[model samples]
Target: MFRILFYRPEIPPNTGNTIRLAANTGSQLHLVEPLGFAFEDKHLRRAGLDYHDLAYVRVHPDLDSAWHALLPANVYAFSSHADRCYTDVAYQPGDVLFFGPESAGLPEEIQRLPEITDRLRVPMMPGSRSINLANTTAIALYEAWRQRGFAAGG
Candidate 1:
């Protein structure tokens, strides 16, 4: 399984959709503090449907706490500014796929952290600002899972 980290996410539905994705894919969802919405937000509940109970979600106090819990594993930071493509990596189980808030992506400082194995980007057409958080996540996760032959997906 992979671990998906959301840093200071601002949208409830986005996180909710991710919860559903995590549940279906057997991935763990880690959220950093200062979230824009509460866990009980109705929009989130609606977006996630009934998958919340099926998903493994953990909320960390901050990025340091997340690192403490998730280190000892490869960390790939997803950023639009990255030179490398997401598909370039040979993802392994337990790899951490890190993402940032919807409005603003990962902070430059965080992206440059020594802990990151690499910074990856999903290719897009010219003038495209960004992809939706949940969409980007699904793209990366599915690709990783596909590379593994969709193990355990049956």
Candidate 2:
């Protein structure tokens, strides 16, 4: 499945939801360090998740480490500033669907990166705020899966 990378996420519940998503979708969850919440088991339990749910979750020291480990797959950075719609990308399996923190979004440098294949957005009315992090990830992942006929356990 496509990898989900949270670039220095701040909220606990968002991360918690994504952990469950990765487990169910067969996607790998990557978290960049300087996270807002502790990776304590209680946090997972409080969010209706169990220790087993984190089997697909991996924490990286920083973006560079994540990039090195993830091998810099075709990255689709989700941003409100993007001109391309998320659905336009021809997502392949193992494509990295990268999302920034809930509040700040991705850094300015990411937008211009040579390796980032595309920048995308879920269309909303002008001047509206962004979608929930988990929801965005879900939409992107399903779209990718849909492109591949929803292959499971591949």
Candidate 3:
């Protein structure tokens, strides 16, 4: 399964939607702190519906801890500033699709990490700010899954 990493995400519904996505896609969701809302936030619960129990969700206290748990795998950082398009790469099952907080994209330091296999972006019209967090996650995850032949999908 693919691993979806959210770095310091600041929105509840977005994370909640990601939980639902993860459950449906057989992917793992990794959240790095400090989170804007509590795990028990009503907005989150409502957005995720009943899939919370079905999803593989792990919360790390910090980025370092997240890296400790997810290392030894290829990581692709999603950033608006990146030069490459997300679909250009052949994604593998164990690949990590890394995203940043909705308020701000991945930090420059994080994007420059040696662990990042590449930096990618979804195509957008010029002058557009950015795509919604949950939407972008879905786009990237589906593309990667499609590249892998949608194995294990029912």
Candidate 4:
């Protein structure tokens, strides 16, 4: 399974939806701190709708802590600024898919970090801002899983 990392995510519903996505897709969700809302926020709970228990979510105090936990893996940082399409990558199990906050995408410094194997982007029509955070995560996750034969299935 891929590891989904959200750095300083700013929306409750987005993170909530991702929690559900991770549960259903058998991925781990790692959240870097300075989050916009509490894990116990009612909106978040409502959006997650009892799926939280089924999901594996880790909260890191900072980006450094997250790096300490998730390094030594191929990290693909998602950003609209990237030249490469996400599907172009041959994703392997245990790869890390990283995203940034809803308002601001991943910082330039983080995007250029040595740990990031590459920066990837999803296609969109001209004049579009960007896809929803949860939806983007799902797209990347499913593509990677599909390439792996959706492993361990019946």
> By lDDT, who's the top model here?
1
lDDT of 3 by residue, 1-154 (tens): 8999999999999999999999999999999999999999999999999999999999999988999999989999999989999999989888899999999989999999998999999999999889999999999999999998888641
Q: State each model's CA lDDT, in order.
A: 0.95, 0.83, 0.94, 0.92
Q: Which ten residues in a row have the lowest lDDT in candidate 1?
A: 145-154
- lDDT per residue for candidate 2 within 73-143, as digits (tens), equals 79899998899998998888889989999988988797678768889998888878888988888888888
Q: Model 3: how far is 42 from its true place, Å?
A: 0.3
Model 3 error, position 149 (Å): 0.9
> lDDT of candidate 2?
0.83
Candidate 4 lDDT over residue span 1-154, tens digit each: 7899999998999999999988888899999999999988998898888899999999999988998998889999999889999999999988999999999889999999999999999999988888999999999999999999988420
- TM-score of each model, paired residue for residue: 0.98, 0.92, 0.98, 0.97
TM-score attained by model 1: 0.98
lDDT score for candidate 4 against the true structure: 0.92
Ranking by lDDT: 1, 3, 4, 2
Cα deviation at 25, candidate 1, in Å, is 0.3
Model 1 whole-model lDDT (C-alpha atoms): 0.95
Residue-pair clash count for candidate 4: 0
What clash count does candidate 2 reach?
Answer: 0
lDDT of 1 by residue, 20-127 (tens): 999999999999999999999999999999999999999999999999999989999999999999999999999999999999999999999999999999999999
